[model samples]
Target: MESAATDNTIWYVLVVLGLIYLIVLYRNKRATRRRKSRRFMEGKRMHDRDN
Candidate 1:
């Protein structure tokens, strides 16, 4: 029973850590996507101006 409890605690900690890691990764991806889109828009505007 003691070993089972220890295993459970370890799994719980790992699950929480994994969730946090995924959230950070998701936020970074969203920021990168937003930055790319903004850059694309700026380039398009510049192209229009040149034409």
Candidate 2:
């Protein structure tokens, strides 16, 4: 019985950690995409000004 409880706790911790990891991964991806879009917009504006 005690082993079962411990196993459940371990699984809960692992799931929480996995969720946190996923959130961080998603945020990093979004940030990189935003950065790339911003850079692209700036480049486009510069090109427009040149023309």
Q: Find the candidate with the highest TM-score and give its number.
A: 2
Per-residue lDDT for 1-51 in model 2, tens only? 999999999999999999999999999999999999999999999999999
| lDDT, candidate 1, 1-51, per-residue tens | 999999999999999999999999999999999999999999999999999
lDDT of each: 1.00, 1.00
Which ranges in model 1 have alpha carbons more than 4 Å from their true place? none
TM-score of 1: 0.83
- Estimate the TM-score for candidate 2: 0.91
TM-score of each: 0.83, 0.91
Off by over 4 Å in 2: none
Clashes of each: 0, 0
What local lDDT score does residue 43 receive in model 2, on the 0 to 100 scale? 100
